[model samples]
Target: MQYNANSPAEYIRQVPAERKPAMEKLRERIKKNLPSGFEETMSYGMIGYVVPHSIFPSGYHCDPKLPLPFMSIASQKNFIAVYHMGIYTMPALMDWFVNEYRAHYKAKLDMGKSCMRFKKPGDIPYDLIGDLASKISVQEWIDFYQNSIKR
Candidate 1:
């Protein structure tokens, strides 16, 4: 679950063998679909996609030294998790994902405030995850975070 790796590739390497493909595919989907300007890094012990200081120098309000995190994927004890800040702060995006998930998968959605959990790696919805990754741009995220979440 927790890997002491310095890069996304290393993190993937440390994940369970059974989960390697899913994790890699998930990472690929996020990377291919996420808008430009979000850099990939390891944040909060997971493979993170962030708005770098070059784009928003203030960085994360909680820790200005670090880039503002937008999304991350981790292999948890029981599941593979996706943490997306947009769905936590944007009601419409949350609603859209919740609705779209039902149309994509038969099993009930397993999720938390910002974490989407998939107990079975094979069931992960790569396309929907890609769509979610593309929904918010870096500037849009910063604007919303400043006005709403950072307040």
Candidate 2:
């Protein structure tokens, strides 16, 4: 969970050998389906997909230097984690994702508000995850973030 990598490549190299393949596959799926404007980088000691500073000048409210995080993939001490901010912020989207996952995967989702923890590659709902990644555009996320702050 300690992310020391200065780059995405370095982050991949740092993942434990046992968990490397699954992490790589998950990363690939996200990248392939990720909406335009998000950039991949090392953030919070994980591989983060974020709205770059150029797209959202204010950056993340929590930390200006860091980009607005959209999603992240990390090899944790106990499991691989996929974090999706879009679903966490929107109740409707969260409901849709949960329904889709239940229908297709037929297993209980090991998840928090934004984080999906997987014990192995098979535990992931790859197609659904990719769709979720593509659900929101950068502008939408920025708007949502800004709106949330005003309330």
Candidate 3:
């Protein structure tokens, strides 16, 4: 009952049947909005879409290979999580994101430093979440790459 962990099929296999559809839907949503150059892969035993160093490479900061946070999607035992470093690092967006969740979602959305966990798809704040995903325009990501290349 285990999967390869290196393949999306393997990752999808472990998700319970009931959660599969929701997980797939989330995957599609994430893919749709992700800025180009972000790689879709499995990480930490869950379906994680990462902006590999290629997009925001190391040395963007002090180290040439410093680890950067990512926006991730994960399926857990009781809920699915939408994770974005932006939630914490981008102060301008966090409060508005939280308020939108409160206004649009009927269920309580639990938050962490970088993630939002929803018990069901219905609980997901889709519009706001999509806006958050799209808020950072592709140009911003490209700019990060260009800047990183210089470092």
Which candidate has the top score in lDDT?
A: 1
Query: Model 1: per-residue lDDT, tens digit, 99-123?
Result: 9999879988999999999999988
Off by over 4 Å in 3: 1-4, 59-67, 137-151
- Model 1: runs farther than 4 Å from truth? none
1-151 in candidate 2: lDDT tens per residue? 7868898788889998988888888888899999899999988988999999999999888888889999998889888999989878899999999889988896678999999998876788888888998999989999999999789
| Winner of 2 and 3 under lDDT | 2
**1 or 2, greater by TM-score:** 1
lDDT of 3 by residue, 1-151 (tens): 2345787767776788887787777777777876665677765566665556665554235355533435667777678888886676666778889887777767777999888888876667655766777766544654654565577
> How does each model score on TM-score?
0.98, 0.95, 0.76
The residue ranges of model 2 lying beyond 4 angstroms of the native Cα positions read none
Q: Predict model 1's lDDT versus the native.
A: 0.95
Model 2 residue 131 lDDT score? 92
lDDT of 1 at 3: 95
